[model samples]
Target: MSSPIFTTPDEVEAAFYAALAHADLDRMMAIWSEDDEVVCVHPGSIRLIGLVAIRESWRQLFASGARITVSATHPVRWSNLMTAVHTVHQHVHVEGDDRLHPPIIATNVFARGALGWKMVMHHASPAPDMDNLHSNDSPHIIH
Candidate 1:
Protein backbone atom coordinates (compact mmCIF):
# COMPACT_ATOMS: atom_id res chain seq x y z
CA MET A 1 0.00 0.00 0.00
CA SER A 2 1.27 3.44 -0.90
CA SER A 3 1.43 6.12 1.74
CA PRO A 4 -1.42 8.59 1.63
CA ILE A 5 -0.41 12.22 2.02
CA PHE A 6 -2.91 13.44 4.55
CA THR A 7 -2.74 17.22 4.63
CA THR A 8 -5.04 17.57 7.61
CA PRO A 9 -6.50 15.57 10.45
CA ASP A 10 -9.95 16.45 9.20
CA GLU A 11 -9.21 14.67 5.96
CA VAL A 12 -8.33 11.51 7.81
CA GLU A 13 -11.44 11.86 9.94
CA ALA A 14 -13.65 12.46 6.93
CA ALA A 15 -12.33 9.39 5.21
CA PHE A 16 -13.08 7.26 8.24
CA TYR A 17 -16.71 8.30 8.31
CA ALA A 18 -17.08 8.08 4.54
CA ALA A 19 -15.84 4.53 4.60
CA LEU A 20 -18.42 3.63 7.26
CA ALA A 21 -21.22 5.37 5.40
CA HIS A 22 -20.52 3.28 2.35
CA ALA A 23 -20.02 0.04 4.33
CA ASP A 24 -16.86 -0.56 2.34
CA LEU A 25 -14.98 -2.93 4.60
CA ASP A 26 -11.77 -2.87 2.61
CA ARG A 27 -11.78 0.87 2.41
CA MET A 28 -12.49 1.09 6.11
CA MET A 29 -9.68 -1.30 6.94
CA ALA A 30 -7.29 0.60 4.74
CA ILE A 31 -7.44 3.50 7.15
CA TRP A 32 -5.98 1.38 9.95
CA SER A 33 -2.42 0.41 10.68
CA GLU A 34 -1.37 -3.15 9.83
CA ASP A 35 -0.20 -4.07 13.27
CA ASP A 36 -1.29 -6.30 16.12
CA GLU A 37 -0.92 -3.43 18.52
CA VAL A 38 -3.79 -1.56 16.95
CA VAL A 39 -6.95 -1.24 19.02
CA CYS A 40 -10.59 -0.30 18.55
CA VAL A 41 -13.31 0.04 21.13
CA HIS A 42 -16.85 0.45 19.94
CA PRO A 43 -19.38 2.19 22.13
CA GLY A 44 -20.56 -0.09 24.94
CA SER A 45 -18.33 -2.88 23.69
CA ILE A 46 -15.11 -4.47 24.84
CA ARG A 47 -11.82 -3.40 23.32
CA LEU A 48 -10.96 -5.08 20.05
CA ILE A 49 -7.31 -5.65 19.24
CA GLY A 50 -5.34 -6.39 16.08
CA LEU A 51 -6.33 -5.93 12.46
CA VAL A 52 -8.26 -9.16 11.98
CA ALA A 53 -10.49 -8.67 14.99
CA ILE A 54 -11.13 -5.07 14.11
CA ARG A 55 -12.01 -5.96 10.56
CA GLU A 56 -14.40 -8.68 11.65
CA SER A 57 -16.06 -6.43 14.17
CA TRP A 58 -16.77 -3.79 11.56
CA ARG A 59 -17.92 -6.41 9.15
CA GLN A 60 -20.52 -7.52 11.63
CA LEU A 61 -21.62 -3.99 12.30
CA PHE A 62 -21.99 -3.19 8.62
CA ALA A 63 -23.93 -6.37 8.15
CA SER A 64 -26.55 -5.17 10.60
CA GLY A 65 -29.82 -3.78 9.28
CA ALA A 66 -29.62 -0.22 10.51
CA ARG A 67 -27.74 2.50 8.67
CA ILE A 68 -25.72 4.81 10.90
CA THR A 69 -24.69 8.44 10.50
CA VAL A 70 -21.99 10.02 12.63
CA SER A 71 -21.43 13.70 13.35
CA ALA A 72 -18.20 14.76 15.00
CA THR A 73 -17.39 17.75 17.19
CA HIS A 74 -15.00 19.19 19.76
CA PRO A 75 -11.90 17.63 18.32
CA VAL A 76 -8.68 17.71 20.33
CA ARG A 77 -5.54 16.88 18.40
CA TRP A 78 -1.91 16.02 19.19
CA SER A 79 0.72 15.19 16.62
CA ASN A 80 4.35 14.81 15.72
CA LEU A 81 6.03 13.91 12.42
CA MET A 82 5.39 10.19 12.87
CA THR A 83 2.09 10.07 14.77
CA ALA A 84 -1.09 11.93 15.56
CA VAL A 85 -3.95 11.60 18.00
CA HIS A 86 -7.46 12.96 17.84
CA THR A 87 -10.08 12.86 20.54
CA VAL A 88 -13.52 13.72 19.27
CA HIS A 89 -17.11 13.46 20.33
CA GLN A 90 -19.42 11.62 17.98
CA HIS A 91 -23.14 12.06 17.92
CA VAL A 92 -24.62 9.08 16.16
CA HIS A 93 -28.03 9.04 14.52
CA VAL A 94 -29.60 5.89 13.27
CA GLU A 95 -31.88 5.99 10.28
CA GLY A 96 -35.70 5.59 10.40
CA ASP A 97 -36.28 8.04 13.21
CA ASP A 98 -35.03 11.35 14.57
CA ARG A 99 -34.08 9.87 17.91
CA LEU A 100 -30.60 10.52 19.22
CA HIS A 101 -28.25 7.71 20.09
CA PRO A 102 -25.95 7.99 23.05
CA PRO A 103 -22.99 10.29 22.55
CA ILE A 104 -19.59 8.66 22.06
CA ILE A 105 -16.17 9.92 23.03
CA ALA A 106 -13.41 8.49 20.89
CA THR A 107 -9.66 8.65 21.14
CA ASN A 108 -8.21 7.99 17.72
CA VAL A 109 -4.48 7.51 17.31
CA PHE A 110 -2.66 7.43 14.01
CA ALA A 111 0.85 6.60 12.89
CA ARG A 112 2.74 7.69 9.81
CA GLY A 113 3.79 4.42 8.31
CA ALA A 114 4.79 3.13 4.87
CA LEU A 115 1.09 3.47 4.11
CA GLY A 116 0.98 7.06 5.22
CA TRP A 117 -1.24 7.99 8.17
CA LYS A 118 -2.89 4.84 9.45
CA MET A 119 -5.07 4.70 12.50
CA VAL A 120 -3.52 2.73 15.36
CA MET A 121 -6.02 3.08 18.16
CA HIS A 122 -9.69 3.98 18.32
CA HIS A 123 -11.12 3.90 21.81
CA ALA A 124 -14.79 4.80 21.96
CA SER A 125 -17.21 4.70 24.86
CA PRO A 126 -20.55 6.07 25.90
CA ALA A 127 -20.53 9.37 27.73
CA PRO A 128 -21.58 9.21 31.32
CA ASP A 129 -23.36 12.19 32.77
CA MET A 130 -22.60 13.77 36.15
CA ASP A 131 -25.21 11.48 37.66
CA ASN A 132 -23.58 8.42 36.08
CA LEU A 133 -26.40 7.80 33.63
CA HIS A 134 -26.19 8.34 29.89
CA SER A 135 -26.30 11.91 28.63
CA ASN A 136 -29.58 13.27 27.33
CA ASP A 137 -28.60 15.41 24.38
CA SER A 138 -30.55 15.73 21.17
CA PRO A 139 -29.14 14.13 18.08
CA HIS A 140 -27.20 16.42 15.80
CA ILE A 141 -27.77 16.18 12.08
CA ILE A 142 -24.76 16.39 9.88
CA HIS A 143 -24.92 19.09 7.27
Candidate 2:
Protein backbone atom coordinates (compact mmCIF):
# COMPACT_ATOMS: atom_id res chain seq x y z
CA MET A 1 0.00 0.00 0.00
CA SER A 2 1.05 3.63 -0.45
CA SER A 3 2.47 5.59 2.43
CA PRO A 4 0.24 7.88 4.51
CA ILE A 5 0.21 11.60 3.98
CA PHE A 6 -1.37 13.74 6.64
CA THR A 7 -3.19 16.68 5.08
CA THR A 8 -4.66 17.70 8.41
CA PRO A 9 -3.92 17.09 12.06
CA ASP A 10 -7.14 15.17 12.46
CA GLU A 11 -6.20 12.90 9.57
CA VAL A 12 -2.84 12.19 11.11
CA GLU A 13 -4.46 11.42 14.45
CA ALA A 14 -6.89 9.04 12.80
CA ALA A 15 -4.08 7.31 10.92
CA PHE A 16 -2.21 6.84 14.18
CA TYR A 17 -5.04 4.87 15.69
CA ALA A 18 -5.68 2.97 12.47
CA ALA A 19 -2.07 1.90 12.39
CA LEU A 20 -2.33 0.69 15.96
CA ALA A 21 -5.45 -1.27 15.16
CA HIS A 22 -3.72 -3.01 12.30
CA ALA A 23 -0.33 -3.17 13.99
CA ASP A 24 1.22 -1.92 10.76
CA LEU A 25 4.63 -0.54 11.63
CA ASP A 26 5.29 1.10 8.28
CA ARG A 27 1.90 2.77 8.27
CA MET A 28 2.46 3.99 11.81
CA MET A 29 5.87 5.44 10.96
CA ALA A 30 4.40 7.17 7.96
CA ILE A 31 2.57 9.47 10.37
CA TRP A 32 5.93 10.77 11.52
CA SER A 33 8.68 12.62 9.72
CA GLU A 34 12.27 11.42 9.45
CA ASP A 35 13.49 14.62 11.06
CA ASP A 36 15.66 14.44 14.11
CA GLU A 37 13.30 16.64 16.09
CA VAL A 38 10.49 14.14 15.95
CA VAL A 39 9.47 12.83 19.37
CA CYS A 40 7.11 10.29 20.88
CA VAL A 41 6.15 9.19 24.36
CA HIS A 42 3.99 6.21 25.14
CA PRO A 43 1.95 6.12 28.33
CA GLY A 44 4.23 6.03 31.39
CA SER A 45 7.25 5.67 29.11
CA ILE A 46 10.25 7.91 28.54
CA ARG A 47 10.39 10.27 25.57
CA LEU A 48 11.81 8.93 22.29
CA ILE A 49 13.60 11.31 19.95
CA GLY A 50 14.65 11.14 16.31
CA LEU A 51 13.38 8.70 13.71
CA VAL A 52 15.52 5.76 14.86
CA ALA A 53 14.38 5.86 18.45
CA ILE A 54 10.76 6.56 17.57
CA ARG A 55 10.66 3.76 15.00
CA GLU A 56 12.25 1.30 17.39
CA SER A 57 9.78 2.17 20.10
CA TRP A 58 6.85 1.54 17.82
CA ARG A 59 8.43 -1.59 16.42
CA GLN A 60 8.65 -3.00 19.91
CA LEU A 61 5.10 -2.09 20.74
CA PHE A 62 3.76 -3.59 17.54
CA ALA A 63 5.78 -6.72 18.18
CA SER A 64 4.09 -7.21 21.53
CA GLY A 65 1.23 -9.65 21.67
CA ALA A 66 -1.33 -7.17 23.00
CA ARG A 67 -3.60 -5.37 20.59
CA ILE A 68 -4.65 -1.82 21.43
CA THR A 69 -7.87 -0.02 20.71
CA VAL A 70 -7.74 3.75 21.15
CA SER A 71 -10.52 6.28 21.41
CA ALA A 72 -9.70 9.99 21.35
CA THR A 73 -11.77 12.82 22.75
CA HIS A 74 -11.74 16.57 23.53
CA PRO A 75 -9.16 17.60 20.95
CA VAL A 76 -7.62 21.00 21.71
CA ARG A 77 -5.97 22.17 18.52
CA TRP A 78 -3.72 25.04 17.47
CA SER A 79 -2.09 25.53 14.13
CA ASN A 80 -0.56 27.58 11.36
CA LEU A 81 0.84 26.71 7.87
CA MET A 82 3.92 25.01 9.26
CA THR A 83 2.95 23.63 12.67
CA ALA A 84 0.00 22.13 14.48
CA VAL A 85 -0.51 20.79 17.96
CA HIS A 86 -3.29 18.64 19.31
CA THR A 87 -3.84 17.85 22.95
CA VAL A 88 -6.09 14.85 23.30
CA HIS A 89 -7.03 12.22 25.82
CA GLN A 90 -6.87 8.66 24.55
CA HIS A 91 -8.91 5.88 26.11
CA VAL A 92 -6.98 2.70 25.37
CA HIS A 93 -8.62 -0.70 25.54
CA VAL A 94 -6.43 -3.75 25.19
CA GLU A 95 -7.73 -6.81 23.43
CA GLY A 96 -7.83 -10.26 25.06
CA ASP A 97 -9.26 -11.24 28.42
CA ASP A 98 -7.50 -8.66 30.57
CA ARG A 99 -9.74 -5.72 31.44
CA LEU A 100 -7.81 -3.87 34.10
CA HIS A 101 -5.74 -1.44 32.04
CA PRO A 102 -6.56 2.24 32.61
CA PRO A 103 -6.90 4.90 29.96
CA ILE A 104 -4.15 7.35 29.02
CA ILE A 105 -3.87 11.10 28.42
CA ALA A 106 -1.82 12.23 25.45
CA THR A 107 -0.55 15.44 23.90
CA ASN A 108 0.21 14.93 20.21
CA VAL A 109 1.99 17.50 18.04
CA PHE A 110 2.35 17.66 14.26
CA ALA A 111 4.28 19.78 11.82
CA ARG A 112 4.09 20.58 8.11
CA GLY A 113 7.23 19.54 6.31
CA ALA A 114 8.35 18.93 2.72
CA LEU A 115 6.10 15.86 2.42
CA GLY A 116 3.06 16.86 4.44
CA TRP A 117 1.84 17.12 8.01
CA LYS A 118 4.05 14.80 10.02
CA MET A 119 3.78 14.09 13.71
CA VAL A 120 6.46 15.93 15.66
CA MET A 121 5.70 14.87 19.19
CA HIS A 122 3.46 12.63 21.22
CA HIS A 123 3.61 12.88 24.99
CA ALA A 124 1.41 10.45 26.87
CA SER A 125 1.05 9.86 30.56
CA PRO A 126 -1.19 8.19 33.06
CA ALA A 127 -3.89 10.56 34.25
CA PRO A 128 -3.58 11.69 37.84
CA ASP A 129 -5.96 10.36 40.47
CA MET A 130 -7.98 13.55 40.48
CA ASP A 131 -8.39 13.39 36.71
CA ASN A 132 -9.63 9.83 36.87
CA LEU A 133 -11.75 10.05 40.00
CA HIS A 134 -15.52 10.10 39.45
CA SER A 135 -17.14 13.52 39.63
CA ASN A 136 -20.77 13.97 38.69
CA ASP A 137 -20.61 17.73 38.31
CA SER A 138 -17.95 17.80 35.61
CA PRO A 139 -19.23 17.13 32.14
CA HIS A 140 -15.65 17.01 30.86
CA ILE A 141 -14.83 14.11 33.10
CA ILE A 142 -14.05 10.97 31.09
CA HIS A 143 -16.09 7.92 32.01
Candidate 3:
Protein backbone atom coordinates (compact mmCIF):
# COMPACT_ATOMS: atom_id res chain seq x y z
CA MET A 1 0.00 0.00 0.00
CA SER A 2 1.22 3.49 -0.86
CA SER A 3 0.65 6.58 1.24
CA PRO A 4 0.37 10.00 -0.33
CA ILE A 5 3.03 12.51 0.55
CA PHE A 6 1.55 15.46 2.38
CA THR A 7 3.48 18.60 1.50
CA THR A 8 2.18 20.86 4.27
CA PRO A 9 0.24 20.94 7.51
CA ASP A 10 -2.70 22.47 5.70
CA GLU A 11 -2.85 19.57 3.32
CA VAL A 12 -2.80 17.07 6.15
CA GLU A 13 -5.55 18.91 7.99
CA ALA A 14 -7.74 19.04 4.91
CA ALA A 15 -7.27 15.33 4.32
CA PHE A 16 -7.99 14.59 7.97
CA TYR A 17 -11.44 16.09 7.80
CA ALA A 18 -12.09 14.71 4.36
CA ALA A 19 -11.39 11.24 5.64
CA LEU A 20 -13.75 11.73 8.55
CA ALA A 21 -16.50 12.99 6.24
CA HIS A 22 -16.09 10.00 4.00
CA ALA A 23 -15.71 7.52 6.90
CA ASP A 24 -12.60 6.12 5.36
CA LEU A 25 -10.46 4.62 8.11
CA ASP A 26 -7.54 3.94 5.82
CA ARG A 27 -7.45 7.52 4.60
CA MET A 28 -7.84 8.84 8.12
CA MET A 29 -4.97 6.81 9.50
CA ALA A 30 -2.77 7.76 6.56
CA ILE A 31 -2.65 11.35 7.82
CA TRP A 32 -0.79 10.34 10.95
CA SER A 33 2.88 9.78 11.52
CA GLU A 34 3.89 6.14 12.00
CA ASP A 35 6.56 6.79 14.60
CA ASP A 36 7.24 8.82 17.73
CA GLU A 37 4.59 9.43 20.37
CA VAL A 38 1.16 10.03 18.93
CA VAL A 39 -2.05 10.94 20.73
CA CYS A 40 -5.72 11.68 20.25
CA VAL A 41 -8.52 12.77 22.58
CA HIS A 42 -12.08 12.70 21.46
CA PRO A 43 -14.80 14.72 23.17
CA GLY A 44 -15.83 13.12 26.46
CA SER A 45 -13.42 10.24 26.11
CA ILE A 46 -10.21 9.23 27.78
CA ARG A 47 -6.98 10.29 26.11
CA LEU A 48 -5.75 7.79 23.54
CA ILE A 49 -2.01 7.29 23.19
CA GLY A 50 -0.16 5.47 20.45
CA LEU A 51 -1.24 4.52 16.97
CA VAL A 52 -3.12 1.40 18.05
CA ALA A 53 -5.39 3.26 20.43
CA ILE A 54 -6.02 6.14 18.08
CA ARG A 55 -6.73 3.88 15.14
CA GLU A 56 -9.20 1.79 17.10
CA SER A 57 -11.14 4.83 18.30
CA TRP A 58 -11.54 6.18 14.80
CA ARG A 59 -12.36 2.78 13.45
CA GLN A 60 -15.14 2.34 15.98
CA LEU A 61 -16.51 5.78 15.21
CA PHE A 62 -16.57 5.12 11.50
CA ALA A 63 -18.09 1.74 12.10
CA SER A 64 -21.06 3.45 13.70
CA GLY A 65 -21.86 5.08 10.33
CA ALA A 66 -22.36 8.66 11.50
CA ARG A 67 -20.97 10.08 8.27
CA ILE A 68 -19.84 13.20 10.08
CA THR A 69 -18.82 16.23 8.08
CA VAL A 70 -16.64 18.77 9.83
CA SER A 71 -15.94 22.37 8.95
CA ALA A 72 -12.82 23.66 10.67
CA THR A 73 -12.51 27.41 11.17
CA HIS A 74 -11.09 30.11 13.47
CA PRO A 75 -7.64 28.65 13.44
CA VAL A 76 -4.83 29.91 15.65
CA ARG A 77 -1.49 28.54 14.51
CA TRP A 78 2.13 28.29 15.58
CA SER A 79 4.87 26.56 13.65
CA ASN A 80 8.59 26.09 13.37
CA LEU A 81 11.02 24.16 11.15
CA MET A 82 10.03 20.70 12.37
CA THR A 83 6.61 21.01 13.93
CA ALA A 84 3.34 22.94 13.82
CA VAL A 85 0.44 23.40 16.21
CA HIS A 86 -2.99 24.68 15.26
CA THR A 87 -6.27 25.24 17.06
CA VAL A 88 -9.53 25.37 15.16
CA HIS A 89 -13.23 25.42 15.82
CA GLN A 90 -14.79 22.39 14.19
CA HIS A 91 -18.45 22.43 13.30
CA VAL A 92 -19.52 18.81 12.96
CA HIS A 93 -22.79 17.84 11.38
CA VAL A 94 -24.28 14.40 11.02
CA GLU A 95 -25.63 13.65 7.57
CA GLY A 96 -29.32 13.93 8.42
CA ASP A 97 -29.39 15.91 11.64
CA ASP A 98 -30.99 19.36 11.67
CA ARG A 99 -30.15 20.51 15.19
CA LEU A 100 -26.88 22.36 15.28
CA HIS A 101 -24.29 21.13 17.73
CA PRO A 102 -21.87 23.62 19.23
CA PRO A 103 -18.53 23.77 17.55
CA ILE A 104 -15.75 21.61 18.93
CA ILE A 105 -12.39 23.18 19.76
CA ALA A 106 -9.58 21.07 18.32
CA THR A 107 -5.85 21.34 18.64
CA ASN A 108 -3.97 19.69 15.80
CA VAL A 109 -0.24 19.16 15.97
CA PHE A 110 1.95 18.06 13.10
CA ALA A 111 5.58 17.17 12.54
CA ARG A 112 7.76 17.39 9.44
CA GLY A 113 9.56 14.15 8.71
CA ALA A 114 10.73 12.01 5.79
CA LEU A 115 7.13 11.56 4.64
CA GLY A 116 6.59 15.32 4.79
CA TRP A 117 4.05 16.63 7.28
CA LYS A 118 2.04 14.15 9.32
CA MET A 119 -0.25 14.77 12.25
CA VAL A 120 1.11 13.80 15.66
CA MET A 121 -1.78 14.77 17.84
CA HIS A 122 -5.44 15.71 17.62
CA HIS A 123 -7.53 16.78 20.63
CA ALA A 124 -11.10 17.86 20.24
CA SER A 125 -13.69 18.86 22.86
CA PRO A 126 -17.03 20.55 23.06
CA ALA A 127 -17.13 24.34 22.93
CA PRO A 128 -19.56 26.56 24.76
CA ASP A 129 -22.75 27.27 22.88
CA MET A 130 -21.99 30.15 20.54
CA ASP A 131 -25.60 31.19 20.23
CA ASN A 132 -25.62 32.36 23.83
CA LEU A 133 -22.58 34.56 23.27
CA HIS A 134 -24.43 36.84 20.90
CA SER A 135 -27.22 37.53 23.38
CA ASN A 136 -25.08 38.68 26.28
CA ASP A 137 -24.48 42.33 26.99
CA SER A 138 -21.47 41.85 29.29
CA PRO A 139 -18.02 41.84 27.80
CA HIS A 140 -16.88 38.44 26.59
CA ILE A 141 -13.43 37.73 27.88
CA ILE A 142 -10.99 35.11 26.62
CA HIS A 143 -7.86 34.05 28.26
Clashing pairs in 1: none
**Local accuracy of candidate 3 as per-residue lDDT tens digits, 37-60:** 899999989999999999999999
lDDT (CA) per prediction: 0.81, 0.83, 0.93
TM-scores, all candidates, are: 0.83, 0.85, 0.89
Instruction: Rank the models by lDDT, top first.
Output: 3, 2, 1
**Order of all candidates by TM-score, from best down to worst?**
3, 2, 1
Candidates in order: C-alpha RMSD to true structure? 6.7, 4.8, 2.8
Q: Which numbered prediction scores highest in TM-score against the true structure? A: 3
Which scores better on lDDT, 1 or 2?
2
**Cα lDDT for residue 38, candidate 2:** 86
Candidate 1: residue 76 lDDT (0-100): 95
Error of 2 at 46 (Å): 1.4
The backbone clash count of each candidate, in order, is 0, 0, 0
Question: What's the distance in Å from true for residue 97, model 1?
Answer: 2.9
| Candidate 2 lDDT for residue 104 | 76
| Candidate 2 TM-score, true structure as reference | 0.85
What tens digits encode model 1's per-residue C-alpha lDDT throughout 1-143? 65456655566777788888778787788788788899999887998999999999999999986677888899999999888899989988778869767688988888876556778888888875645333546544337
